[model samples]
Target: MSNDSPKLTPRQQEIFELIQQAIATTGAPPTRAEIANQLGFRSANAAEEHLQALARKGVIELVGGTSRGIRLKAGTLRGLHETRRAPASAGKSRLGSLSGLTAGNLPLPGLEQLVLPLVGRVAAGHPILAQEHIEQSYAVEPSLFTRTPDYLLRVKGMSMRDAGILDGDLLAVARTREARNGQIVVARLGDEVTVKRFQRNAQGVTLLPENPDFEPILVGPDTPDFELEGLAVGLIRKDF
Candidate 1:
């Protein structure tokens, strides 16, 4: 809104409006590919280029390696709503004056900070969860997940389709050396590693596949060689 702010080209302005509208309604911004689809651009890279330009122009801010991190420079509706609720009448008192009455006597912190490592391309037949394979780390607010994740693993297969985990989805994994029965986990069975909902009976433990097309793998008790790598906390999918 400032004259000093760099001006966007007509095409860039159109893309900016789309992003703004998306954030206003959904409380999150659109992905680069979504912008491309909206504007009928043939390549997602074109949308990414425009987004970078907007960031350079001070029109928006981008949080790398995470979905829905785009924030508009212009005030959002939530900001305007808070402004409207401020003390407007002479009789109406403000809460800031009573802050000392609270337990902490301080404003609440925004959100919990947790760094999640992004592990690319999990190989089903290998130990892909090794620490050395982490490509990047993303700082996320812990409130975003049901449980805090030790790291984020990029899902590579459609084995858990019925569990709603699709290929290319970001799986939030909580690191645990042991796992209880009937928890969805990232596990290593011998040389192979996989994500599946676990089930254990007197016979043995079964790695149940959520997708009907995929068969469940049974590991006998005699072969107690499998390692429970971690528990799945949550998932993230980029809309494009």
Candidate 2:
């Protein structure tokens, strides 16, 4: 058995599944509170305890203060021998293939791996979709972002040129259904997607453009529904 597949109690297995789902869907590991909620525990501490147990068993790694920071150990795959053998070559296959089967295909060091698709445009505050907006996907480690971002946005306009987020730059975006004050975010207003520095007031939220020439956009307390797709985590520039 692989070291990644260390035996665990049923509770640990449940926690493992929850962490996997959170990482797959959110680009980050689930929080203690989220794990608790999913497992129907009354307190987040309960989930934390279980997670601690998992960490001790070498099945998962954890990064504190980061959402969805749990990384499943590689080499945990249970049935590698069955998948690797071709029927005709089953008898001739090398022992290395059977011995090398792990929980995941990549090495353990790559557990925090995440591949984010570069999107062409965002619907200003709406989620970036691979089918409709993605230009390409780049492999990245989740730790590169302050918060794990769900996708990358390909900037198209110069509204944020002054902020070093130039047109054509790829913006790493952390997906959150909600937004807080003073965060650089990808927002959707109507069908349009825009990147702006976000600020909020009692009156409403303002989407501020980095360039002084561009005016800040004010959203009324109530108006068209807006979406907070994600926060800007990092940027990458391609060479001409």
Model 1 gets an lDDT of 0.60
Off by over 4 Å in 2: 1-112, 122-127
TM-score of each predicted structure versus truth: 0.50, 0.50
lDDT of 2 by residue, 1-240 (tens): 333357879898777766644433432356788788888999988988898899898766654534434555433322222323446435321111001112133222634567877787544444468476777777654433335667777777778754445677677777776766656788887777889878888898899886777899998967586777777765555544
Q: Would you list the C-alpha lDDT of every candidate in the order shown? A: 0.60, 0.61
Give the number of the best model, judged by TM-score.
Answer: 2
Query: Given candidate 2, what's the lDDT at residue 187?
Result: 83
Residue 16 deviation, candidate 1, in Å? 34
- TM-score of structure candidate 1: 0.50
